[model samples]
Target: MESNENEFNPQQPNEHRPEQSAYGQPDQHVTNPSFKSKLELTIFSIEHLREIAKWSKFLAIIGFVGIGLNVLGLGFFFLLAPNMSPFAAEGLNIFAGFAGFIGFVFIMALYFLPILWLYRFGDNLKKAIDMNNSAELESAFGFLKKHYKYVGILIICFLVLYGLIIVFSMLGGLFAAMGTL
Candidate 1:
């Protein structure tokens, strides 16, 4: 009779089996899949998570309020752009306001997603802690991941933009120097 690799041997329980792992059968693709989480959340960790949830919620609310105020300010700015004091040059008032409006809108659009993700993370974290539900905990973690991912991507974009600006500035300066010479 041929011995099956999948069958657990009760007689040789202490012997290391290539097919078995600490968490049952080993994944074929993952070599040495024995890393089990020993992290049993102590009181200190739970308390810290609670504090983080609270702070996240607080910051998210403040962000929302700031966004709301900025929106209101933009509306007023648009309404009063034409009535503003005349600039030294003609049509500069509307152009300045429009430029400001575009910049603000861009900033707000960038700001919104992370704030929303942060809020969801906080809300879900609170629910997870209160209800002790793994599903809610998973959801909270997902939101946190999304928030970080968005911020990371935004940071990369800003870095690229900064690099482009520096390159353009250097080129412009070189051109200006060449023109003078």
Candidate 2:
């Protein structure tokens, strides 16, 4: 049997068809869905994102708990250092302990920024999906972008720091060898 031109057929490609999406623009459905466009990600993939965000938010809260516990440890050690006798306290080097605590806290604060971003991303994503709010959805994705950007910059900073440490050590070694001669 011959198919009629007016009848819609799955086997036939219809390029001229104008299908409306949420807006009046033609619906752009991905034939090869290996990669999704932003529109597809925001609209169609929200359920997946919500699930991911739920888990991520849980983990970030757990991390915050871990940091709080670490603060207790810092306090414990800090308190222990000062209780020693005056001479012993000097030998114990409470200042070093204090410095270590400060440094640890500074690092933790740096890490907390990314965790905050992830938490915001997760919370906003969950809320946006529930409310079907575009503004909230955009905020969720913006936090995700900032999380990535901050992590990338942190990695670059660490690499540069490692490079500087290596160069300084090598120079120190060369200076020691010359001084020995």
Candidate 3:
């Protein structure tokens, strides 16, 4: 039977290989594996981190714009209803105030969502970089998989906070009316 040259020869005496020292054994002088090449890993990690950074920057800009819109809406409300109290009357101004409040809350929540995404993306990016440095591919993917839940919780928390602020504002208005009466 003829063996192919491409096949490994386990039985061959590799005289070119150096003998190990007899203190049990010295460390083998095996050539580093191709997969351990620093250049390839560094390039891959840098590219991945660059992608994350780009997305984070984009989200940050969007969040800023959303926050600006919310502020503008608040300013508009104050300008239009400078002296009108919620308790004073029920009319178009009240409807406008309610609409403004809801719009502000929605805008605030929208701003918070992008911020949350940026944070979670940044966390995952750091984990990915660490994993790449340590050669822990599984852990890097695991961190990415868990990022969604963090974003979801952030949005939920923002909604709860917005609701609390609205409730407190209404309560303060009621109390102020009672104080004046």
Give the Cα lDDT of each candidate.
0.77, 0.73, 0.57
Q: Put down candidate 3 lDDT per residue, 1-181, tens digits, no spaces.
A: 9966434332322332223332224336764333332334467667867677567657667776778786776766644564564533554566666676777777577556546556555555665565543212323333444445656777799899999999999999999999999
Candidate 1 clashes: the total is: 0
lDDT of 1 at 83: 62
Model 3 CA lDDT for position 112: 66
Tens digits of per-residue lDDT for model 1 on 43-121?
8887898999999999999999999899778856754755662451566767776777778878998999999999999
lDDT of candidate 2 at residue 66, scale 0 to 100: 80
TM-score of each: 0.73, 0.69, 0.37
Report the alpha-carbon TM-score of model 1 versus the true structure. 0.73
Q: Residue pairs in steric clash, candidate 3?
A: none
For candidate 2, write residues 88-116 as lDDT tens digits. 44676577667667888888888898888
- Candidate topping TM-score: 1
Point out the worst 10-residue segment of candidate 3 by lDDT. Answer: 15-24
Clashing pairs in 1: none
Q: What is the C-alpha RMSD of each candidate to the true structure, in Å?
A: 8.5, 11.0, 16.6
Candidate 1: which stretches are off by over 4 Å? 1-36, 83-88
Which candidate model has the greater TM-score, 1 or 3?
A: 1
